[model samples]
Target: MINKKNILLAAVIFPAVMAFGQQYGGMWIPTELNEKEMKAMGMKISAKQIFDPAKPSIKDAVVQFDGGCTAEIISPKGLLLTNHHCGYDNIQSHSTVENDLLANGFWAKNMGEELPNPGVTVDFVLDIKDVTGQILGNTKNLDAKQAEQVIKNNIDVVSKSFKTEPHQKVIIRPMYYGNKYYAYIIETFKDIRMVGAPPSSIGKFGSDTDNWVFPRHTGDFMMFRIYADKNNKPAEYSKDNVPYKPKHFLPVSIKDKKEGDFTFVFGFPGRTTEYLPSIAVEKIRTEIDPAMIDVRDVALKTLDEKMRADQATKIKYASKYASVANYWKKWKGEVEGLTKSDAVGKKQHYEQSLIAKNPEVKTTLDEFNRLYTEQSPYALSRAYYSEVIRNAETLSLANNFYNFANAAESGKMDAKTLENFKNRLTEIYKNYDPELDAKVTAKVLALYANRVQPQFLPSGFEQYKDVNRNLQTIEELSKNSVITGRGTLNGATMYSGIDKVFEDQNSLVQNLKNDPLMKLFTSMRESYLTKTDGKYAEYQKQIDVLQKKYMAQQMETDKNRTFYPDANSTLRVTYGEVKGSNPKDALYYGYQTHLSGVMEKYVPGDYEFDVPKKLIDLYNKKDYGIYKNSTGDVPVNFTATNHTTGGNSGSPALDANGNLIGLNFDRQWEGTMSDINFDPRFSRNIMVDTKYILFIVDKYADAKWLLNEMKIVK
Candidate 1:
C-alpha cells in the first residue's frame, strides 16, 4: 500500500542513531536490566539493589499512586512523596472557600492530624515474574480471537497461583506486543492520608502557561503517609492503624548535581509507543491529534473565560480545566515535535533498514501500512466522538440517562440499579455548572458536524445543518431537557425517592424515551454503536496481528541492539543525565531553575505566579541552610535526559548511588513527543530538586517534625 521510494526518502532525511549506542530512551523492565550498560553510564549500585524481592530494594519503595501516578517511600514510617498535582484531587476534595487548603497550604504537625482519604490507595510491587511461557505456550495454533481467550484464561490461572494477602492484587500484563507477559504481585494499602502540601502558588506556580515547559520554578511536591495495621500489614482507615514500615526507603541527598551527572528514574510509566510504525505516527500527528486538540482548545478557552471571571467557578473547574488542558497542550507539542524531529521519517528509516535486512518482514509492514491508510478515517472520527460527545458533560450525562431508560424499557430496571445510577448522576452534577456545560455542548457538537465525515456523523446531526442553527437547537434542547428537570423529568418529586421509578418502569421508560434530549442522544449513540462498533474492533484485531509481527521482526533483525518493551502502566527504570537541551538553531535551555526565578515570576494577587510571603522572606534572607548549592543558590527544578511519561509524575530521580536527588514531575513541551518518538537531544524530564524541597520544609513551612523523620544526607 505504501511506496518504497517514500520510505527510502524518509530514511535519507532522518538522522539515524549510531549502530550501537546508549540511547537515553526505553522504559526498561527492572528484572531484565542491562547491568553492563548501567555500569557504563555510572551506576554505583547493583541491579539487585534496584529490584530484589528477597532484599530491601528501590522497587520496594516505589508505588503506583492511586493507579495513575507514582509515589516513593522516603522514610521507614511510610512517609510518601509524590508530585503535588498527583495529590491535587484529594487536596481539592478537602478545600472550601473558608478553609481553602488549595489556595493556602496544609500541614499536619503530628500523625493524629493527618487527613484520611477514603478511596485513595497506594500499591507496592511484591514481585514481578515472567509468565510468557505459561500464557502463550499452548496457543501456538489458535486464531487471534481464540488465542486471546486462552491468554486471558492463562493469566487468571497465573494470578491465582500466588496466594496473596487480603488487600493484595495480582495483574498479568502483556509486554513487547504480547510476545511476553509479566505477572505482578502487588499489595494495596487503603489507609493513605494527606500530610502536607505547599500552597498552589508554590505547588502550581506558573500553572497552565508553564505546565509542559522547562525553566520551571514550581515546588510541585506533596506529602502523604501510608497507614497500616499494628503489624504493618494493609488495612482500611482506622484510628488504631499505624504508619507502614517499608522494606526500603530512599534517603534524601543534598549533593550538588552538575550538567553531566548521571540520573535514573524509577516509577510506573503510564504509556509509550516508541515502536510505532511510520504510517501510524503520521495518522496520529496529522489527523487524530488535531481534531482532539481543536475540541479541547474550544472547551479550555470557554472554561478559562468563566474561571477567570469568577473565583467560585475557578475552584469548581480548576481540576477539570487542568486535566483537559494537559493533554491538549501535549498533543499540540507532540505534533510540532514530531514534525520538527522528522519522527515519521525516522520510523520509516528504521523500518526500511529492517525490511532490507529481512525481506520476510515485508508482509507485516505492508499490511500495517494498508490498514493504517484505510483506518485513518475511522480513527479520526472516533477521536472526535470521544472529544465532542464522550467528554462533553451534558452529552455524557445524557448517555447515562439513555442507558437507564433502555434498562427500563427492557424490563431490567431494579431498585438497586436505579439507586446506583442516581448516585452516579448526583456525583456528575456536584461540580457541574449547567451554563458552562450548555456552552461546551453547543460548541463541541457544532465542531463535530463541521469536521467529521457526514456519512459517519451522528444520526442527530440530520436535524440541524449549520453551526449557528445547531447552536440554537442545542440551546433549546438544554432548556427543555428532562434530565435538567424539564418536560418529562420536570417532577423533582419523582427523583426524591428514585426507587419509586422501579414501580412504573413502563411509564418511566416511555417518558424518558420521548424526551427530546434523550431522543437525540439515543440516536447519536445508537448510530455510533451500529455503524462503528464491530467495524473498529475488526480493524483493531488485524492491526494488532500486524503490529505484533512487526515488533517481532524488529527484534530478529537486530540481535545486538537491545530491545526494551514499551511502557504499559508498569514499573520501569529509565536512566540518563542531568543535562540542558538545544531546542532550535540558536536557542539553548539550561538544566536547572533557581529560587531567584521564582521571585522573578511572582505577581501580586496572581493565581499562578503568586509566592507565599514566608517563602519570600526566607529567600530574601538567603536562609537556605545546607541545602543551598555550591553556587550559593537554592535550585528549585532541574532537567534530565531520563525517559519518562505520564505515570512517572512523582517518580524519584535517583543519583549514581541510588539516593533520591529530585522528584520527576514533567517533560519538556518539545519532548512530549518522546512518548511516540524519543530523540535524546531534546527529550528532557523535569524534576523538583530535593534541596529545594527540604529548604521549603525547613525554612518556609518550619516542618522540622517531618524533616526529622527522613534520612537526609548532606
Candidate 2:
C-alpha cells in the first residue's frame, strides 16, 4: 500500500559525491589524525596540533558561565562572553516592571554591582582525550546495538572513575548516537555574574521578522563574568566571589576573518538527527506538518487578534509567539522546500541503488514503507489529539496533585531528585501564561472539531464540526470550561492541584481511567507504538547495516585514514571556509552582515522584528565606531558553512589560528532543513561577530573591569 511515487522519488535524489564514500567530504577532517596523517591529507595541520590545549592555537577564549549558556574567557582574570538571547529568558524571569531589564537592558558597572542567577553553571572544556581503544576493546563479535552499548558502558565506567581528576567533570556521550563514544573531562565554574547587555532595541533589533533570514541586523549578543574560590578553583557563589585566574585566555579578535577564512565552531551542541529516512521526511513535509500548521495558524491568528486588542494578552503571549513563530516559519519553509526540491527523489534513488547492490537493506526499506503506509490515516489524528495542550494549566494542577500522592507513598523525593525536579520546573512555572494557554488549548480543540477525521474526534467535540475554530469558536467554547465538574476534579482539599487529582479516592486520575481525554491519549499512544515504532526499528537496523557497510568500505579503501564515525554527537568537528553563497546564482547571500542590516530589518511593529529607537538612531548616524569593519561599519554580521545543528547554539566560531571570533547561534531559514539535506547554498552558520559582542560589552554595558580583562585586538 506504500506509494510507489514516494519510493520512486527517493531512489535518485542525491549526487554521488554527497551520498557516498568520503568522511572528510564536507570540511571535517578525521579526529584520529596525527601531524603526519593530516599533512598528507592536505590538512593545514594535524588535528591534534589544532585541538591540543597546550598549543598556542588553543586559547582561554571561552568562559564557563554557571549553567545557562556557554561563554568564552577572553581575559585571564575571568571575563565571560556569550549571546544575550541565550540568557534572555533568565533575565526576563527575574525582571519586574519597576526594573524591566529586558525592556531597558542591564549593565554591571563593576563586580560589586554584578547580579547572580542561581542554578546556572558554566563549563570550561579543559581537555579531550581519545579513549576509543579502551571502549572498542573488542566489538568484533558484538552486533551493532550490543557494540554501541558495550562502548557506552565502558565510557560511563571510565568517566565515573575519573572523578579524582582535579577540578574536572566528565560526560560520556555516544557520537553518531552509538557508532562512537567519548568521555569528556571538563572544568566547571559555579560563580558567574551578569556583566553587560545592550537594550532590546539594540540586542534584539528586528526581533522575529528578520530571524533566520538574511539581510538581518540584530546585535544578538551579551557578556558575563566568572568568579573562583580563594584557592583559584571553581566554586559556587558566595559573598567572597573572587576572580579566577586562567592558564590561558583567548585573545579577542575578528581582525582577520576574510571571506575564505577556514572557520570552526566548538561548544556543547544540543543534537541533530541527520539520518532520517526519506519516507519520514516526506510524511512530515506532505502530511503531518500542513495539518498542524493549519491548526496552529487558526490559534495564532486568534491570539494575535486578542493580543493586539489587549495589553495583558499581548504580554502574556509575547514569549509564546516568539518561542514558536520561529519554528513555524521554518516548518512552512521546510515543507515548501521539501516539495520543491529533489531531496526525497534523490534519497529514494539512493536507497534503491543500495538495495540493488545489497538485498538485505531492501528488507529494511520495505518494512519501513509498509509501516508508514498502514499508519498514515491515523498518524496525524493520533498526533493532533494532544490539541488539548493550549494551556498546561491542568498539567501543573495535575503535577501538584501527583506530588501530594507521591509524598504519601514515599516522603518528598530525595533532596537530589527534588532539586532536579525544581530545576526542570524553573522554566515551566516561570513561563506558563494561563490566558494564552487557555486560548492555545481551546483553539486546538476547535481545530480537532473542524479539521480532524470525524471518527478521530470525541462526539462531544464533533457537534461543532465544519466550523473555523477561530471564527466560530465562541458559541461552542463559551460553555466548555477546562474543568467539566468541580466535584469530579477537586474532590478533596488535599487535591489542591491537578497532581492531587491522582491521589484522592475520588480522583480525576481514576476518572481518566475511563475518561474521554485519557481515551484519546491512550488511542494516540497505541497508534504511535503501532506506527513509527516499526519504522524506527527498521531505520535503526538500516543505520547499523549502513554503518557497517560504510566502515567496511573504509577498511578496504584507506586503512591509514583516521576514520571518525559520522556525528553521532558523542562528538563532532566540522571545518569549512567562510564563504558567501548564491541560494541560486543571482539571489546571493553574502557571508558577512553589518549593523545597518539590523536597522534594515527594523519594522515599526512586527513582533520579532521591531528595533528600538535608540538602536535605530545609532545606526542612522553610522555610529558603530571602532567596532566597524575595515570597510567601515563595525562588522555586525559574519557567516560560515560549518555543518552545524541545533545543539551548537552558543558554540564558539573559531578562525584558522583557533582565535575566538563569533558565537554560532542559528542557521538561516533556507537551511533549517539542513539536518536532512545540507545544501551548501543556504546552510551557512549565523554567528554574532566577536567584535560586535565586545562592542556591546565594552561600550553599551560600560562594565569597565570586564572590558579591561579581555585582550581585545583592534
Candidate 3:
C-alpha cells in the first residue's frame, strides 16, 4: 500500500522530485505475496514469488546460476535466461566474422550446441537472513563513529559464522543507513557458458543513438545457460562438462492483451538517490553536470573525427566510441535537464523552507550550503581531470597495485594469474592510443594546476611549478611520450600492487602524499565545503531538529499513508496503473511499438541502427511463428513507468497477476532523465516484447523444448 500523500508529493509536488517519478522503487513484484495484486489484472506471479527460494510459485524451479545479471532456472534440465550484452565480452572473445555469434544469433538445437565461456560463473543466493538484531542489537545510543565500526565488526563476525565453507561467498549490506542489515549467502558456479546471442545488428540494433531514447527500436536483449558437474555442484568447464539440470523457465502466451494492462519488472536493480539535499541537487545542476558534459563532448568529438577519417581506426575504436558517445549523450541530456528544469531554484527554495520552519535546522542548512557552495566548482574540475583527461590515472593506480604486490610479497602471483596480467598489459599497451590519452591527460591536469592549490601537491611536482595556467607547460613535458606514457603506464607499478595495497605500509602513499600534481588535483576537489566534517555535523544537527518537526506535520497532514524510506538497494514495492501520458498536449509517447517500426529504422550503410539481414529475412518470411503478438506479428514494444535506475537492467517486467509479460531492458531516453525526473508522459519502461523474444527462439532458433518447459497461460 502506498501513502496517498507521499505518492502525491512524489508524483506532483516538488517539481524535480516528481519529474523523476519512476526512479523510486524497482522493476517487478519480487514475491508471491505480490501475486494477489498481479492476478487482479490477469497476470501470473510476482518475479519475487517466482524467484524467491522461499516462495512456492517457482521456488524449486528457480536456480540462481550466477552471472553479472541474474538468471533463472527455466527447465527440467537447468536452462538460464539473461541479457546478451552482459555476455558481450565472452561472446566477442570467441567470435570471428565466420561464426560471429553476436552478429548471427546463436541457437543450440540441443545442449551440445552450447559454447563454453571461461572465467564466467553464476551465483545462487542460497540464504538471506535479516540481521537487524545482530547489528543494532546493542549500542543504540553510540556516537556515529562508534556505531560505524561496531556495525562493521558485528557484520564481520556474523558473516564468518554464516559461511558454510570457503567456496561460498558472504555479503552483509546495511539497509536504511543504520536501520537494518541483511546477510546473503551465495553459492557461486564458476563455469558458466554462452548458449546463444543474436548479432548486435539485431540484439543491439539501436546501439547508442537508440540506447536511452525512444520511439526506441532496439532488441537490446539476449539469453545464456549455466552448466554444472554431474554431482549438481558448481564446476569448471571441460570437454566433460554437461548441461545443468532442473529449474523453471518462463512460459509464454501470445494471447492478446490490450493497452493499460498491469505491468511490473523484477531483477536486481542496482542503485538510486531518492534521498539528497536539494542543496546537492542545485550543485549538480549548476556546476557538476554541465562541466562533465563539456569535457566528454570534447573527447568524443576528437575521437569521432579520427575514427571517421580512418576505417581501421573506427574498427579499433568501435567499443570506445560507443561507450564515450553513449555517456556523452546521457550527460548532454542531464545538462538539458539542469538548464531547462527548475532543479536549482526549486532545491534552493525547498532547503530554505525547511530551514525556516525550525530555527534549530538553520545551522545545518547554513553549513551544508556553505560547504556545498565552496566545493561545487572544485569538485567539478577534479571530476573532469579524473574521469575524462587523467583517465589513465586509474589504470595507472591499478597497475601500481599489481606491481607493488608482486614486488613486496613473495609468491603473490600464481603462474596463470601472472600470465593473464602480463597479457592484459601487452594488449592494453599495444593498442593504447598514447597520443589521445596524453592530450586529454595534459588538459585535465592543466585545469587542476590552474584551478587548484599547490599546498595539495606532492612536494616533488610542487617544487617545479605553481597552480596556474602554466599546466600547459606540463603538456610540453608530456612531449617526451617515451617519458609520460612510459611513466604513467609502467612506472605506476612502483606505487601500485595487489599485495602492497593490502599491506599497511603507507610509505609510498606518504612519499607521493606531497606529489605536486596529485596535490593540485586534491586541492581542486577541496574547494567543495560539502564534505567538511564540521559542516556535516552541523547539517546533521539541523536535520535532527527539522525531521522531528517535519515528521509530526507530515503525520498529521498525511495520515494513514505509507511512506517508505528512500531506496537503499533493499527490497521494496511500488504500485501504479499502466497508462500512457501526454507529456505535452501535442506530444505523447505511446506505451507500445511494433516490429514494423524496427524495420523502418533499417538503413543500408549506417551501422548504428541497421537491422540484420537474417532477422529481416525472418520477418519477411511472414512467419510470426510463436513470436507474434496480438497483432499477429512479433510484438516489439511495451511500457511501464516503474521507478528504475542503473541496476534495474534485465529485470523481468510482470503484468498484473504476476505473469511474465515483458523483459525491462531500458527506459525511454525522454525518460532517461527518469532517474532525476520521471515525466510519466515520456518516462516508460522499454521492454523486449516477450512474444518477439519467443519468436526469435521458436521460429528462428527452433527451441521447441524451451517452449514446453514453462507453464504458459493467457
Candidate 4:
C-alpha cells in the first residue's frame, strides 16, 4: 500500500530541504537550470546570459580541448586557455632531449612562432536538443539490445536531419543512465597550435607532492590558438590556416577574489555515479578499487625506481608514470574518503526513506541488493583483468600483435589495416621500455594469480602462482618472444619486423601460439571471455535497467527537487563560491595561494619545486606589474566549491559577472571523492588564477604581444 499524500509531501519538502542544505554538488545541465537557486546564490547574470542557443552566450566560449579536457576562447582571435597538464602530451610530442620545451619552457612572441600540433582538436557545442521523445517512441515491448539498436538507429537518422556545416558533426549522448537523451551539434577545429607554456618549475610546480593538496602555488595553465581556413571554416592543419574568429570569448579578470565570491564552471565533465546504490559503493570500496590500487602500486614502484636511476628513462616514461600515479593516488583517496564518510550507510538510509514513501518499489530495492551481491565476484574478476592483463604495457602490446597475426592468418588483414597496425606499433615502441614492462608484467600476473579465486583466476596462471617463479617465467619469455624486442638487433628495426612476420600468416600465428607470453595471454583472455566477461555483461545489463528504473522513480517522486542527470562526458555547468577546506580538525587551508608561497617551496635544481631565475628576480625587484593583489603578492592559484572532474580540467572559472577569473586544473585532496559523493565541506576545485597567467606571459615570459591580444579587465 502506497500513501500518495505522504509521497507528495516528502517529494516537495525533501527536495526543498536538500536544495537548501546541499549548495554545491550537482553538475547541472544548461538547459534545465534552476534559475531561482542561481539567483539566491549571488548570480549577477541571468540563465539566458549563461546559455542561449539563439545568440552567443557563455557556452559558446567553452569547448572540449583535445577530447579529454576543456578550454575557453579568451580573444576573438581564437586564443585558447587550458591546463598545462592538458597540453602536456602535445608539448612532450614536440620536445626532445636536446631542446626539451617541457623542461625549459616555450613562448611564441608572435603568431608565426606558435608551434603547430597535429591531431589536436577542439569541439564547440553549436546546439543541444532534447531528443528523448523522438528516440524512445515505440520502444515499450523491445528487449534491451533491440531498444539500444532503435535508439542508435534513431540517433543516426536524427543526426543526419540536422543541417550542419563542413567539419561539423552531431553527437547524441545518453544521460541519467539511458533514462534521457540529448543530441549535440558540434563544430570541430583540427588546426590547433600551442602558443605559450612556462617551464616545468612553474607549470608543474610542487609536482606529485603538492598535487591534489591545498596551500598550492602551481601556475598550471597553458595557452594555444585555434586556426581556421581563409573562409573562417574548420580545416585540417595547413600553413595557410589563419586564427579563428570565435563567436564569443571570455575576458580575463584580474580583480581580487574574496572568500564567498560567486563562481561557476562550464565544461565537459567525464563521469559521475552520485546516484549509484549502496551495494555498488560497498563493492567498489571493499573489492574492486583495492585490487586495482594494489596492482598500480606495484607497477608504479617499479617504474619510479627505474626512472630515478636514468635521465633518459625518466624522460621516456614521465608522462606514462604520471598518468598511472595520478589515478593510483586518487583511487586510494576515494576509498578512504568513502569509508570515512560512511557512504554506504548514508545511501542505505536514503533508500530506506524511498522505500517508505513508495512501498510498491520495495521489490525493486531488494532486486538491486541481490543483483549487486551476485555480481560482486564477476566484477572483481573483471577488475583484475583490467588492472593486470589489460594494463600491463607489454602484455597489451603482445595481445595487439596476437590479434594482428590472427587477422592475417584469417585473410582479413588488408593494406589499410596492416599499415594502421604498423604505425601504431611505431608509436607504442617509441617510449616503451621492454625490460620495465616485463618486470611490471610479472608482478601483475602474480598479483592476479594470488588474489583472484581459484576458479575465477585466469587459466594457466595456476602454474606460475609462486611470485619468484612468475618473475623468472616472464623474464625467460621476454627473451624468447620477438614481440618484446629485447636483445634484438637495432631494436629500432625490431618493431618494424612485425610487418615481415605478417607476410607468412600461418607461420606467424604458429610462432605466437608457441610463445609463452602469448600463450599465457590467450589462456587468461579465454577464461575471462567464457567465465567472467559474459556473466559480468549479463549482470551489468540487468543492473543498468534497474538503475534506470530507479532513476526514473526518483525523478517522479521528487519533482520539486532538482534531479540533475549524472555526468556522461557532456557539457555541464556547476556553480559555487571561492572557498577553502578543513580536511581535519586542525588542518585548515586558505582559498588563495601566492608567489611568496612558491618561493617558500622553492629548492634549487629540484624537479618539482624549482623557481625560475627570472621570476625570482622579479620578486626581488617587487615588480608586481599591476597583477598583484592589495597585499602585493602575485596570486598563483585558488580553490572554489565548483563541482568538477577529470574532463573539467582547463575549464574556465567565471565570476558572478561571467568573467574568466581562473582556470580549473585540479581539486583538493579530500575533494577527489567528489566524483562519487560531493561534500561541500571538503570538496574544492583548485584553479590557476587569471592574474597569474597574465603575469607569467607579460613579465616572466616577456610575451607582451601575446598579452596585448587578450581583453584583460582589472
Candidate 5:
C-alpha cells in the first residue's frame, strides 16, 4: 500500500516524449517511441513503420525466442534467426557421440529435413495497452499484502475480460516498481523447427576467453523456421503443419556499414536494475557478485577439467559449462566495470543532489541505506544456499527426491505427477555423472561451510567444516545414494522400477528420508526456510516499497530528467549507432572484426580457438562471394552503442532503414554492468554481422536454398 505522500508523488510517468537531451540508451516501449530523437540520430523509418498493429511493421517480424532470448523472421515463409547459444539446448538434445552436431554443424538440404523441437516456441506481440489505472485503481489505502492480492485479482479479471483471439495470451507486467502496468497480447507459435546451425568452431568461437570481449569473431547465429496449422495460427507440432507465412520479415542488408551509422536493437530485453540506490549498488559490487562468482568458479573448474579429458563428458556438460561460465565471467567483469566506472560514487553524488533539491527524499534514501545494511547478511546467505544447491548436482537431485517424497506422503502425488517426476529424473540422469558431481560437491560444500556465517549454516553442514571428512562422506554417498543409482543399496536406484518403488508411498518416503545426500539437502533447505528466507523476504519487501517511492521522488525532484521503466522481459526499442569504445586509458576497440582476426587467433586442436577446415580453406581462397564487405574481407562480429542486456541475445540489430544488418549476441565485458549502471563510455552490445551469416550458409555450408528465401538487399 502507498501512503498519501507517495500517492501525491505518483503521476503518469509515460509521456509521449519522455527523454530530452540524451541521444542514446533507454529500452523504450514500442508504443511510446521518441520518433524525433530517433530521426535526429539517423533513423530513416517512421515510428509507424517500426510498430503498427493494424499493418505490417518491423515489430511483426521480431519475437521472444523460447521465452528467454529474442529472434526475428527473415523470410515470408517464417524463417527465424537467433543466436547459436539460444538454440544450443535443442542442438545438444539431438547430438550423440556418433553424429555430434555441435562439433560438426547441421544443415537441412530441404524443408522436409528440418528437425522439429518439441517444446520450443516463438511469441509475437500482437498488441500492447496501458492497464495501470485499472490494476491500481482500488488499492491506495490497502497495506502491501492486501494491495498485492487486490492487484492480482484485478489483473486476472482484466486479462480474462480483454478482447483477444483464442490463440493469443494476455500478460500483464508491472513497471517502475508497480507504478505502472502494461498488458501484452502475445501469439505464441509452438511448432518451431531447426533449419541450420554452424559448428562450435564457428558459432561458439573464442568460447569463454572472448565471451564478453570485443574483437570477437564468433558467428553466434542459428536458423529455425516456424510452422502453423491450416489456418496459419498457433498449434502443436504436427506432420500436417506447414511453414508459417509471416506478415513482415526483415530485408537482409549487405550494404557496407560505417562508424556511427544508426543502429537499433529490437527484442525482449531482460531484467535490469538501473535505479538502485548507492548503498544497494555497493553491496552488489562488494558482496553479492563475488560470492556467486566464487561458487561457479569452483564448479566450472571441476567440469572443464573432466570435459577436456572425455568426449562423452564434453557433450553432456557443454551446455552446462556454457551456462555457468557465461554469468560467472559476466559477474567478474561487472564487479570490475562497476569499480572502474565509479558507479557507487556517481550514484551517491546524485543522491546528495536529489536530497538537496527536495529534502523529503532524504527519508527515502535513509530508509534504503538502513534496509540494505540490515539485509546484507541474509541476502548473502540466500545467495550461498541457492548457488551451492544448484552447482552440487547430486544434492540438487536429492532435493528433487525430497520434494517428491514429501508430495507422496502428503497424498498429492497423482499418476501424472509421478510420470512427470520420472521423465524429469530420466532427463537429468541422461547427463549425470556421479563421480564428477561428487568431486564438485566436495569443493563447493567446503567453500560454503567456511564462507557462510555460523548462524546461517545448516545443522549437518557444520560437519562439512572438516574438509577431508566431508570429501570422504560425499564420495560414499555418491556411490550408494538412491538419487545417483551408482551402487546397489537395497535395490533402490533412480534408473529402473521407479513405478514399483512408488507403489508404497510410505516406504518410498522413508527411504528418501534416510538417504545421506537427501538428509544433507533437507538440513540446508529447512535451515534456510526457518532462519534466513523469511527475514530476507521481509527486508526485500520493505526495500521494494521504499524504492518505488524513491523512484517517484526522483522523477518529481528532477522534472527535466527523462525516465523509462527498467526492463522486465518486454519488447523494447533501444537505438544507438555503430560505434567503437575506449574502455580504459589508452585502450581502444574497433567497431568490427574480420575473418583475418579469426585466423590470427586460430589454434589447431584447441578447444576455444579451433577453426573449421572448410572455413580455413574458404578464407585462404578468399571466397567470400557477395557477402564480403567493402574492405574485401567478410565481417565476423561488430560492436554498437545500443544499450542491451541478457535477454537481448538473438535480438535483431536493424540499420537506419529497418533492414536486418546484425544479430545481437553478447556485450563487451566492460558493459556487462550496464544492467545496473549504464556508462556509455564502456557499454557496447556485440553483434554478428548479417553478412557473415550469409557467407557461412552460402560459401562454407553451401546452403544456397536458405539464401534464396531471404530478401537480400545489396
Candidate 6:
C-alpha cells in the first residue's frame, strides 16, 4: 500500500516543481532562513547580519507599530517610518474642525512641537528562541484536551520564567499550526510621538479606487518618533522623556532601482493561511468572503452618500469608512484572484499528487473535506453576524453597554472601570452621527435578515426584514435610549448623564435590558453564542488538530520541499526581485510608478486625486533635487515579488545590503489573494519609494530638519 520508492522519487521532483511555481515567496522566520537560496537570489548580506540577537542588526531597526502594522527606525534618534494608513487612527485622534491634521497634514518644526500619542507603542523583538521540543515533548502521550492544557501551562511557565528586563516581556507563538513554537522577547516603548504626515491628497492619493491597484503614485508614508526614559528603556509617556536611541537604524536609500534588483521586506506580517486544505480555500473564496463583502458593500454605500453630503460627516466617518472599505475591496479582489489563478483547482491537484505519493495523508485529506462540508453553514452565519455588529455603530454601542451592564451585575465594574467606560463612550460619540448610524443599521440588518438561512437567523430578526420599518423603529428608539444619549439627555447634558446612569447599577441594568437596541444586540449575540459560536469553534479545534497532524505528515513525507510557517503577526523576512507582471491578458505593468503619474491622476478640488499646490509647483519647477532618479522623475511607488499580507503594511522594503529603499504599504489588486494562494506571476507587494518620501518631506512639506537626522544612502 505504501509506495516508498515512488514517494522518494516524488519528493525529489515535486520540490523542484513547487519551488519554481512558488517563486520568490515565503515569509521566513529570521532565525531559520534558507541562506543558500537567499544568497543565490542575490542577498549581499549574511543571514546573521539580518537577525543577530546578540548584536545590533536589521531586526533591531524594525518594530511592530501600534500592535498591528510594521514600522522601521530610520534614524539613530528613533525616527520611525510607516504608512499613513497604518498611523491613521493616531492621526485622526488628534484632528478636529479647527486643526484637521487629516486634511491639511501636520509637521513638527522641532522635537518640542512633536505631538505625543498617549497609548501608542512600538515593540522591538529582542530575541527569538525555539522551544518546540520543550512545548511538545510532554504532550505525546496525553489526550487532546489534556495536551492543550499542558501546552498552555508550558507556555505560561516558559514566558514567565524566561529572563527579561523589567520592561521586556516574552510571548510564545505557535507556528506551522502548533507543530513548532517560538518565544519572542519584546521591549515595548510607549512614548511614541507623531512627527509628520502628508495631506490625505498625497498620503491617500487615489483613495478607494486605487487602493489595491498597481501603477499607483500614492505617497503613503508617515513619520513618528520613539521616546524613552532616561536610561533609554521603555517607559510610560512623560514630557521629560528623551528621544530613543535605537541600536540600529535603516539608512534611507534614494538610489535608482532596476527591474531585477534583490529586495526583502523585514517586519511583522499579520495572519496568512497558506496551508489550508483545498476545501477550506474554496469555502473562503465562494461562501465566506462573498457574504462578508456583501454586508460591507451595503454599509459603505450608505456611509459614502452621507459623507459626500456633509463635510463634518466626512471627517467623522473617514477612518470608519476606510477600515470597512479596505477588507471589503480586498475580499472582492481575493475572489477574483482566486478564480483567475484557478486556486482551488491547483490546490486539488497538489493534494492529489501528495496523496498519490504518500498514501497515508489520504485519510487526513478526506477528514478535511468532511469537516469543511459540515462547517460551512456555521462559518457563514458567524461571518454575517460579525459583519452586522461591526458595521452598525448603534448595535456595537448597544453591545458595549450590555457588556458593561453585565460586568456591573457581576460586581466587576469598579470606579476606574466606570470611568474608562465613560471615556470610551465619549470617544465613540465624538465621531458618531446617529442619523448616519441608523441608516447603516437598517440597511445591514435587512441584508442579514434576507441572506442568512431561517435556522441560523437570530430570534426576532424577522422584524428587520422590512427595511423602511426597521429604519423608522430605530429612529424612534434612538430618541429616548440612554445608549443613544438623545431626547431628555441631548447634547452636552447627555454626556453628563453617563455618570448618573452608573450611580444605580440595578436601574442601569434594568434600563439596558429594556432598551430596544440592547435587545437586538442580545438576540444576535445570544444566537451566535448558543447556536453558532460553540459548534464553529469545536469544528475549528478538530480541524486545527488534524491540520497540525497534516503539517507534520507533509513535512515528513516531502523532506526536500521547504516550508515556511504562515504569518501570525511575527517578525519575518520575505525576499524577492523587483519585478512587475501581466496580471491580466494584454495588460502589462512596470515595476515602478513616478511622480508624473500623480499629476496625471490629479483633479482640482477632487477628494481623492487632488494634488497639493506646493507639490504641483515643485513638479512644474522641476525641483526634484537629490530625490530625482537618473531618468529625471521622482519614484513614487514600486512593486516587488516579496510575499506579504495585512500587517505587512509599513514594513521596510530593503535593498540587498539592508538599506531601507521603500515603505511596503499595499499590494496589487489581483495579488491580494497572496494570503491564501500566492501566484508569483501576479502577487506583488507595493511600496512607496523612499525617494518619494524624502522629496515630499524636503520639498513639499519643507521638513528638511527631519531629513537631516536620517542616514541618506546614495
1-714: candidate 2 lDDT, tens digit per residue: 113573355335422222221222232322443334223323354465445566533424454344434566677777666777887866786689899988788887677887887767777665556665677787778877787687767877788777544668787655443445566667777777777677777677767666777755667777667788888887878978698777666777758467757666655444454445577678877887787667667667766887789887677667777666766777776676565555688668756765666676666676667666556666676545443333234333343434533554565556566445545544454545444554555556566666666655444556544444533443333223223222345543211343443344334435544543334434434544565455556655655555445444433444333433444333345555577665553577777887666665666866556766655666677666577787787677677677776555666777655567888777777766666665554667788887777666655555566667767765
lDDT of 1: 0.85
The positional error of residue 671 in candidate 5, measured at the CA in angstroms, is 1.2
- What's the true lDDT of residue 420 in model 1? 84
**Candidate 4 RMSD to the real structure:** 4.6
| Candidate 2, poorest ten consecutive residues by summed lDDT | 14-23
lDDT winner between candidates 3 and 6? 6
Q: Give the TM-score of candidate 6.
A: 0.92
Higher-ranked by lDDT: 1 or 6: 6
**Runs in model 4 lying further than 4 Å from the true structure:** 1-24, 96-98, 238-240, 308-315, 458-460, 487-507
In model 1, the Cα lDDT at residue 97 comes to 91
lDDT of 4 by residue, 445-476 (tens): 88888888888866456876677887787888
| Best prediction by lDDT | 5
- Per-residue lDDT over 1-714 for candidate 3, one digit per residue giving the tens place of the 0 to 100 score: 223686686455344333322323333323323344335434544456555655445433333333335445555556666666666777788788798767666766666777777777766555567787997687577776687688889988888887376457888876543465677777777667676666677678778667776676666566666667787676777767666665444554455557656665545555544335567666666666666666666566656677788887777777777776676677666555544545556556645665566554556556556666665544554455455432443224333443535454565556566557555655555455655554554544444444444433334444333423333544454443222233332234322333332234344444334444344444433432333334445555555444434444433343323233344443334443455545444766666677888888888757777776667788788777655665666677666666665545555665565555666677655555545543444556677767776777766667776666656664
Which pairs clash (backbone N, Cα, C closer than 3 Å) in model 6? none
For every model shown, what is its TM-score relative to the native structure?
0.92, 0.78, 0.77, 0.92, 0.92, 0.92
Better of 3 and 5 by lDDT: 5
* Residues 1-714, model 6: lDDT tens digits: 113684466457555423632442699999998777777667899999999999999999999999999999999898999999999888898999999999899999999999999989899999999999888889997878999999999998888879888789999999999999999999999999999999999999999779899889999989999999899988899998999999999998889999879899998888898888899999999999999999999999999999989998887887779889989989999999989989999889888888878998899999999999999999999999999999999898988988898899899998899889888988888888887888899989999999888788776678889999988988888877778776332233245576665667787788778887888888888888999999999999999999999988877886657888999999999988899888877888999899889999989987778998989999999999999897899999999889999889999999989999999999999989999998877899999999999999999999999989999999
Candidate 4, residue 637: the lDDT equals 93
- Predict model 6's lDDT versus the native: 0.88
Each model's RMSD to truth, in Å?
A: 4.8, 7.0, 6.9, 4.6, 5.8, 4.6
Q: Model 3 Cα displacement at 496 (Å)?
A: 25
lDDT measured at residue 222 in model 3 versus the true structure, 0 to 100: 64
Tens-digit lDDT string for candidate 5 (326-366): 88999999999999989999899989999889999888888
- Candidates 2 and 5 compared: the better one by TM-score is 5
